[model samples]
Target: MSVSGDKIRHRYDRLAPWFDSLEGFLEGLIFRRLRKRLWAQVQGEHVLEVGVGTGKNFAFYPDRARMTAIDFSPKMLEQAKRKRERKQLDVHLDLMDVQSLAYADNSFDTVIASFVFCSVPQPRKGLKEIYRVLKPGGQLLLLEHVLSSNKMMAKLMNLLNPLMVRLVGANINRQTVKNVQACPFKSILVDPTSSDMIKLIRAVK
Candidate 1:
């Protein structure tokens, strides 16, 4: 990794604690609806989540599905471990990077990412891996914050993105949905949130 990327990663390691704390609030207020919507499309299968911060989606997954979640922050993964301690579930949480995943090609039946595309050092490379690691016909479920088509909002996000990434380890101006659709997968469902900040999309590869 470059020096800048290394520095950015160290920043995330430091912020993991605060990020972990917000998982509950985020899950209750935001992810609940998004997860419920995507859960119907992907269930009872071998599932993998990239950038699986604090394992927020672990509970949302159906009981029958075997879930393996990977994240770059060890501290974040440790917090996730604590959260799952009481729930006897089939979930394996790993501290791993997204740009270079260790899993084999076509290793999973489904792949999910929730609000994760923003901070990845190379979002396109990570998406390609998400594509390669999925079994044929496997679904890719994504809940992403994206660049708005609204000119005013887009301009605002572009202005804030660099500072946001520096302070919060997040990018506010990523074209996450467009990047995902650029792959070979056929987009089966795309439900854009009315306000346009987030979108729930499911694609079949």
Candidate 2:
């Protein structure tokens, strides 16, 4: 892992215990519905979920799909493991980095990420790894809070980004759609699900 990756992992490890509680309000008011909508589009039986922090999406996972969820933080994965068992969800949780996926090429039929990429040390590299692992015609689904298109809001996000990263290991200003477009995905579609900042991005490999 890069120095930035190491720092992010450590920061998230430290934040693991309080992770769900910290975002509980937003999860209840907004994220839960978005997560269900994102998972509802699952295309096939094999699926991979990146950045499965504390298994927030575990409750929405498709029962028919074989799920493999990965994260770089061990403490976070531990929390996720407990959630998995508590929920009685059949998910494979692993301590892994998105920028360096261990799976073979064309391994999964669908790849899911929610509120992830903003914290990735090398977002494009991680997207490329996702592209490499997805089977041909497979889909990538992402629900991310991105840099706002509104100039004033974007400037504010950029100003706050550094502090956010320091505190939570995530950047508040990231052009996630543009990063997805830069990858070799066959097609890309983006929907602004929350104002113009949070988006539901879909791409095909």
Best by TM-score: 2
Residue 166 in candidate 2 has what lDDT?
88
Residue 2's C-alpha lDDT in candidate 1?
A: 20
How high is each candidate's TM-score?
A: 0.89, 0.96
lDDT of 2 by residue, 6-39 (tens): 8998999999999999999999999899899888
- The true-structure Cα RMSD of candidate 2 reads 1.7
User: Which pairs of residues clash in candidate 1, taking residues 3 or more apart in a chain or in different chains?
Assistant: none
Best by lDDT: 2
Residue-level lDDT tens digits of model 1 in 6-64: 66677777877877565678767876787777666675379898877766677677777
Task: Please give the distance, in angstroms, between residue 188's alpha carbon in candidate 2 and its true position after superposition.
Answer: 0.5
lDDT of each: 0.78, 0.91
